[model samples]
Target chain A: MNDRNRIPIIITIMVILLIMVIGFTSQQRERLTPVEKWIGDFFMPFQRIVSQGYYGVEDQIRTLIRSSEIKQENEMLKEELHHYQSELIEAKLNREELMELKNLQQTLNSIDRSGFSEPITANVIANNSGNWFQMFTVDAGERKGVGVNSVVIGSGGLIGRVYETGNTWAKVISIIDNSSSVSFRVLRDGDLQGIVSGSVDNELSGYLFDPDAEIIVGDQLITSGIGLYPRGILIGGITDISTSADQLLQNIEVEPAVNFNRMNKVMIINPKIYEE
Target chain B: MRRLFLGSLFFFSMIIESTFLSYLPFPSLVPNTTMILVICFALYYEEKNGAIIGFTAGLIKDMIVGRVVGISALTFMLIGFLVGYYNRKVFVENATTPFVLTAASTILHESIAFVAVFLMGYPIHVTMALNRIYLYQTIYNALVAVPIYFIMNQILHSHFLKKSY
Candidate 1:
């Protein structure tokens, strides 16, 4: 009866369980586990507190060490003030001119969201720590109409798509994740299309469909409107481009428009744009 | 009580890496603190304890940040068991032991994880992942492990003090 050498049985069971969990999670797009949602929501407030403190400290440090930047900002503010003062005098002279100005501004803004609805804003509460996967949790979720596949954009350009959401928190898998890929074209030439993919280095690189596309460094890239992302979201500028080893496709490196490490706020594209 | 302490310690360490260090300006070099804890714990205790700690830490991570669960759990558990299995063979007091062990463990973990992910059909570029990402990660972990080892030794002086000498 001393044959109770049971360590192997336990290890085997664990291995089998792990494989099953992996299989289940990998195939799931959203609601992979209620456990994940509960844990994410439970710790969200704490993560928010930490992010706020970090933001406060960062603002202080930036103001302290950025005298040159502050001076530039001061100059810009002065210019803005002067411009506004002139606009005010002009407005006093002609009320109709002011209405025209308002219309022009609205028209320009409409182009940015012409096909989209008003975007919902969210705060990034937590980010993945190590350099493994590019992901984070935002404070807006299903309660705010944020659902899986909602496009997230920052001040720069396209951020990523929401892969999971809870009541008050949603998880975003950013475009810079190695597993994420986007179809894009050179904004300079719409015919020059390529696939921009993320890597473990947290960098963006892609390959062009045509080897002779005549693209160059510093050329802007935008979504080609072929995939989950809508057309015209600025991806980034090409930093380097060279032919692949086989020379069939042009390999290009990109610097994403948004700095993933320092992102604070993001906007989620509303799903109601098509219907309305 | 000891289990509670270790559990909370693992939780905090996990947060420090994923939340705090992640927000840092130069977070590229942030060490894997939870993995470090698992390695140290395995070294300080039995193989069974090591595997258990590793499994728990990895499971929590998967629940929090992992896209697919079990990848981290399997790799981290293996690391814990291997380290703990040979815990008594190496002198813990030697300043270089942690540096060496951490470096090796990180390499092993990254390689196994990379292969696992690739096999699972994620579109990762191999040369880029190995050259640009995991290399830096391994070096950074080894560097951080030195100071972390001394701190852990200080906290659990009684258990590991004799083993080091």
Candidate 2:
């Protein structure tokens, strides 16, 4: 570890570092080829293991929080017996809402009669660091009929689609993903078909190419039943519209009804099977 | 055997990071924890083996969630080498250097990722992206880095540096 030896080692390391940076930059500039895709698939298992461990930790925290809340409630009820009836009614309403959500899920499942008939339910595993697009991993995977391109829906509406799948886990690309694009139509006036695209920050928006297409800020957007996704699933609501003086199409912004960050339960829609 | 175990642990942690930890709702400007933790680890263990581990971890990460290929691997490798080289000379055995380095490295890692995306013909709004990167996420990553470093260091030490004690 003499100064002369250290200097040469540092210079060699710096040269190696320089070469690596150049190689990486060149690779990033290119499109993701089949080789890259294969590599991505190979690494998916590692992602799942990490996701599962964090989920386990979070699950314990959630259980502790719930149990503590329940204990507090039990103690409070001893002194405030009169309010018990109202609390009971509130609890019943909460139960009913939960049941309604379950029913909605079942209905969604029934409609999605793909070859892979089993339903996959996943918990919200994570969020992005500082970007608008929030992603999640579900416990369901190939073993449970989860696959890439499967649709995911939350309580609010169509959340996103499965982008990566492992044996026991899957990663969802939320609709807010900047690269995501879906063919959607206005529920009120089905005439307006436009491509909904995600912004850099997952602020959902799109461009309607048809100049005469009838659309407004309050209109609802639903999957157009074109391409990978099935028809009539709710996407989001139009939040704003901006028309440039010379532009042919109307620039639009949408606020996704589905709060992907808070979603605890999601149903993965198996890819549809077409009859010959 | 220890190297294998440590390698698997780091690999598993990256996966959890992309899948689940990425979904947590932080206040608008929090940086990603995984990027910071990985950077810190790369800096703390800058040996040839450490660089290899860092590169493997980055490669695994790139495959899982990143759009670009090789970027994370290259970045992690560089950070690992620098950190390792620095550690050998300056002796950052304490926690403060990790905290400061984690903060700086998180920013560097994100910038590189963002620049890579932008350079790939993607029409990115640079200002907005930078806002997310520097303001919220940098702060968040710095805060989370200490705990993650502590946990990861303990795991690495127990698994790989058993003879040191």
Candidate 3:
């Protein structure tokens, strides 16, 4: 009974320590603690393998389901088919990304912000386990100049910010996370600004600072020079204006420009480099 | 053998849950099969081993997947202790034991996590958190518990089950 009785006392101490850890981690700490970095780095290889293998398996499963008739016909041929099918899918995906990259480049060029250093490209290595929070780890990290709050841009626009960084990897929390909020300026009318936030459903909703601001559906949005984000990064276009219970703050829904589902590669930019 | 097997199972579950489960067809579910693993051991051996397993599993998950560390660890640890403490009174072997316990634990786990994250100042919609995340995950984890429980029982029979009896 002594051992059994001691469990609660031991657990009480542990629970308190764990709570303190939770509080410390919740803050916007730029670098990973030594223990955290070691663990993260240790798991990096396995996570990388699993992420890649997961995609490969997904492609294989999709191929099998799409051609169930052919799949049942031959086991040997199925293996061969899976190979060719994955290759074909990978090539198609590559082309789509190329087009997206080209479009992003064109948009950046048109915007004419050439003072910024070249964006560090990072391969998304692993997605955070659960769907409740929107976060993913990328291969680029402190070594590549990617640090906390560095803006992560995907194919279309802003994905999120680097929440934490290791020597060779960084965890990015997307704008669509329930906890994340971004300040935006309506692109159509530059002075009309608001705060946009993400919800659990991977959707964005925001309210204008000025309740009387002239805003409508289909208006574009960009990052305002407030908060951690710098000015002029494209956010998304307004989708619908909802009649909220609170008339003091006019709320609007937004369709984020980045197609988060299909986003794989991202560019990390240090805000200080360009904000100056 | 028990130590080695349990270690492998813990590491395997961590990798699979974080990597493969997220990409599976269902988008809204987390399928926390690891919680079932903790519950099974707790039911068999009770709190002493249970708390350690729960804490270790939760710690791995937090280090890898969690945005906020210690939430899962704390919740899982407490759940393991509570489950073991209550499980000590009922020594019967029933098929539904693991299943029902897993379902209950999932809800408790998610609720603790939900409250913790919310308290940490994350804006969470109540309906979305309840309907989409907590409910969906509870069903998935409960369903997964049966097979996992049987397998774990089978594996632990020689070394662990014989000792207590």
Q: B1-165, model 1: which lDDT tens digit per residue?
A: 555666788877766666677777675557787888888888887567788888889888777766777877977887787787778565555877788888888988788677767777877767777764567778778888888888886776665445554
Top-scoring candidate (lDDT): 3
**Share of reference contacts found in each model:** 0.60, 0.40, 0.74
TM-score of each: 0.82, 0.68, 0.81
* Candidate 1 residue-wise lDDT, A45-76, digit = tens: 77777877888898899899998999999999
lDDT of 3 at A174: 90
Residue B124, model 2: Cα distance from true site in angstroms: 1.4
Write candidate 3's Cα lDDT for A1-276 as tens digits: 688889999999999999899888877775567877877877777777887777777778878787966666678787889899999999999989977877798788765344466799987777773756888888888888887888899888889998888887888999988889999999988889999998888899998888888888899999997998878889999999865687788899999999776556799888767764
Weakest 10 consecutive residues of candidate 2 chain A by summed lDDT: A25-34
Clash count for each candidate, listed in order shown: 2, 18, 0
Clashing pairs in 3: none
lDDT of 2 at B77: 61
True contacts kept of 2: 0.40
Best by TM-score: 1
Candidate with best DockQ = 3
Please tell me the TM-score of chain A for candidate 2. 0.60
